[model samples]
Target chain A: MNKLCQSIRFVAPFLLAICCIACSNDKKLPFYGQREARITKAADGTEKVDTVYQTIPPFRLLNQDSIYITQDAFKNKIYVADFFFTSCSTICPTMHRNLKTIFDAYKNNPDVMFLSHTIDFKYDKPSVLKKYGQKLGVDGPKWQFVYGTKEEIYHIAEHDYLVAVQEDQSAKDGYIHQGWLVLVDKHKRMRGAYDGTKSDQVAQLQKDIAILLKEEN
Target chain B: MRKIVLFLVMSTVIVTLIYSCQDAEQLEYQTYYSNGQTLYQTYCQNCHGEKGEGLGLLTPPLTDSLFLKNNRTVLACIIKNGATTPVTVHGKTYEEKMPAFPKLADIDIAQIIVYVTNSFGNKMGMYPYADINKDLKSCATR
Candidate 1:
């Protein structure tokens, strides 16, 4: 009886530890935006319910390389996306500086990607973006700096990514915008949004990227 | 034995305090330097970077001691009024127009100059706030 009690005490803690680990492994990043359940009849006459997640819609814009790219370019890949202009001197420098660290950290990982959309419709042409990208040390395919019309870019920024941007005459460089480094999952759903200018938020973004990568595989 | 012990303890305290004390000049430099660090973070750090390494080729790095020395007099003016002219730093030319900071006081500019020149691999000694007015006058006349 004494031997059984001792073994049970040891085995019970071991089992509890395994349970905790398994629970944590099952933990996944939360899905942003509204979701809904869809009920369907299965082949075996049972109901199968699935949650439909809001996803990044279709987008085709000019890249820094002067080539047109579509949403299909990021197919099966997770990406970090942000909006800024070449001449913005306010938060953009700090944002890009912090994001550059993340880019360097995940440079070798092909599945991870970066996308920057320029909101300046008047001046930020493809050639300017190319030069900016080259100077920013992100002249490659993994990090695509894109440019689009004010209508398309602003519409998508407001409706799709949930970031706010506008042109203000009194603002610096004639524009003002938020600095959100949005993290999107493999399915193109936003998993996290971190303030690109804050060190703590950027660090949290680094950790959350690892979590999302694990969740993807 | 107690006398020896007290002497040892007293000497240790005195030595520590003496080594920790900053001289008058050092105290003045520290006043500028520490305040300058905060100001740099607020104004220049975004473009110049935390290490003054500057971003890619878009912004010029502040590590060029020669350029700083050659343009040391006009540095205050450049801070006050933006620079549209291209600048050659470390053998590379940066053409982007630097936005002006008209809000900074002369003393604030002096503090930033001291901090930047001292940190980021730069060893230029203290730039007295008293000398800044003359430099600003020189720049305005140019």
Candidate 2:
């Protein structure tokens, strides 16, 4: 009995360590959105309710290369999206820097992509976005700096991505945009929203992106 | 006697370990400097980096910069009034505009200066609130 107790004590810690490793490796992430119930008639004439996940609406925008991109471009890819302008003086630089860290981490992975939409559509043209991306040492379709109509961009930002952005004439630069870095899955569902200006949250975003990539596999 | 000797040796070892583990900076004038450090982390660390190593050519480095050393008075004004024009730091010109902190107290500016100047290979000593107040007053008038 003494020998058995000694062996059990030796194996218990190993079991606990294995359990911890397994728990830590769990890549399941919660889906964020409004769930709507839909009623459908069964084959036997019984009614059944189905919950549907809100997804990103289809979008059409121009990339930095002046290439027209649509939802089909990111059909089977995970992406990180944020809103910013070329001339933004506050928060945007930090946001870009943090996003750059993520870009560098996953630059080689074709499955991971980035979408940065310019809120100031009038000023940040395709040429301007191309120049800005060049200045930041970022190249396309891996990290696409997109430009589109202000109305469409703002609509997608506020409605689809669940972030706040608007044109505030009174504010600096004649525009206002949220600093939230939104993470979207392959299915165009928003998996997470993190503050782009914060490094810790960005780090969490990187971890979550890894989990999402593994989830697709 | 042996018990007393063992207690003395153990006490000495414990004292040395405790002293070694304690942060020397925290022991010396922590109130102003530490507050400044926290404020720097909140406001400045993002663009300026955690160690004031600045972000590329856009944001200029604050560590051991000839600009910070020469323009100590202007630094106070810049902190309160913001810099709209291009400024040269460490022989490199940075055109990015730094926003003003009109809401930060004069004492807060002083504490931030104290922390920035004392850290990241800078040894410029404590910045008193009086100097900041006088500089801000001059900036306001200008």
Candidate 3:
């Protein structure tokens, strides 16, 4: 009886160790928890506050084809939107590069889309935007380059989406705006915004979009 | 017989506990991008290649030793505040102009750099984001 008890004790611990290792490496918890949390938080290190929307504003603009466009064109689609000018000498290139990633990812998903709004309506006429789109290699139809009146574009940029867009004549190029990508749901509510230049933030944007897509419609 | 069995059981339990109690190395593993890989795919892969190898005839490769060792300063500067002149990497000259990444915060640059360095077989030691932040001031302002 004593020998049996000793053997049982010895085997029990070995089994427990194996069990612990197995549990620690469980496939279900594949990602590190700390990293996941960081991705889910805000840049200021606080938890992100989700914005609820009651209505989406309406506006008119020109598409890359020189056709008249409006908010109604998006009707019921989930779209990712951002503001940039064709000749922007700063963050615009990086924004285009980053957005290309999102464009490629959902290029086949007919329901998902991209809207690149030009802050330089004067320069970014359909022809200019079409050429710029060619340079960036934007997948046609999946991504639309939009141009509208400076006043209306600036108004929507600042008030509606809360993005910064201004004409800064003092600064060499006479334009200024942060590089931001806003994700809007089917209902036209702002679900999230991402730093178009940073891949990690964009990835978080992708994840948030996925989350938003999964939400009950 | 019972005494032998008990001895064996106790030995097994001790061995298990001893092995399990070993402490893990205290290396600090930063959670980069957390979503960095995904973000890289979305924003950087188009120009930098899906793996930092640089797009052919368009951009220079980051993973190449020529650029990594020679132009670390210029590279850091260019990323923060776009590049103008044609630069060389791996002994070959690259003429493609890379635009600046000004909208990117200090942390974002760090994460992208780390992602590029570690991935695509670049393997530059994991530099802290703070270092990038310090370097960015001189690069962008100048």
Candidate 4:
């Protein structure tokens, strides 16, 4: 009985130390948010977020003015991008508000660009997006609201960006999508994705952009 | 020897308390509205404005008093199916097209609704998930 008690006493200290370490690490690495992100395999089997160089595929979209835009539109600029439709009464509003802060924060910086893509191309026509942009006071050339075919939008959202964008009749709202803000480097590779509606995460996103911009290409 | 044993037990208790405290704060909101407020800012603030007044004319003000009173059904329907046509709230007309959130569950809708209804002084009482589920079924017909 004495031996068993001593053994337990010996083990208890070690267990307590481990618990303290674990509790601290939990704060350091949360289950969701900026720190939890990991580079993983994409749908096409290519590794997502290659830090070596920007190798993302080109995307063709229409600007708010109904002008055609390719990936070349973002050449040599660090940009933040997100997917949203205009009429959404849910997360899109909060995400837009959060991005607005980041946008206003870096509005004067020439290197920073903001891209908002519309998943509902059928309704979010270029003119409509332009009007929406105007309403949000988003002066394009620094910020661009994009629209494209539904298939194209969904494809980029799922395969390229690895974000959730699904269409389902059974969904309570009749469709489903994720709320994510993707950060892309000048080379068009995703450097990070933050919760678009989080002030702190967006703040971190701003910090990361500054970091990425300073890095040598 | 007593000191060492006491230190270990104290450390274990402290660690347990810390973790339990964090888990409680992160998950235990009695109302989803309080939780949804953070979720809204995390996800909807960009286009909606930080205050939920919306991003200029791009989005409509959830704080509109008369609008909220008159368009409960429209607001609920718009949340469920999204909107393309111009939805006139008060006298001002907003025609911006927004995405549908078909994946949001009844509970999520209820929380967001309650949040909107309460946050901007547009009080309509606390909408329970059960009520939202019932309203959603009626919404499906029209």
**Which residue pairs overlap in candidate 2's backbone?**
none
Q: Model 2: what is its DockQ?
A: 0.18
* Candidate 4 chain A, run of 10 with poorest lDDT: A26-35
Per-residue accuracy of model 2 over B1-142 as CA lDDT, tens digit each: 9999999999999998888667454454467689899988876776787778776666778975566789888778888778889987777777767877778888888888888988899888767788887888788777
Task: Give lDDT tens digits, candidate 4, residues B22-88.
Answer: 7675444335768668656644555566566766667777778777777765555677777788876
Residue A72 of model 4, lDDT score: 80
lDDT of each: 0.90, 0.85, 0.70, 0.74
DockQ of 1: 0.73
> Cα miss at A21, model 3 (Å)?
27
Error of 1 at B108 (Å): 1.0
User: Comparing 2 and 4 by TM-score, which wins?
Assistant: 2
Candidate 4 lDDT tens digits, A1-217: 9999999999999999999988866222112122233578988998875334434579888898888888788889878888887766667767887788788988888888988888876678988788778877785778898888888888888777768987666854445788888888776667788987667888888777777776734
- Specify the highest-DockQ model's number: 1
Q: Which consecutive 10 residues in model 1 chain A have the weakest lDDT in total? A: A25-34
TM-score of chain A of 1: 0.89
TM-score of chain A of 2: 0.85
What tens digits encode model 3's per-residue C-alpha lDDT throughout A40-111? Answer: 476778786443343448877788998887777777788888998866645666677777777778777777
Stretches off by above 4 angstroms in model 3 are A1-54, B1-142
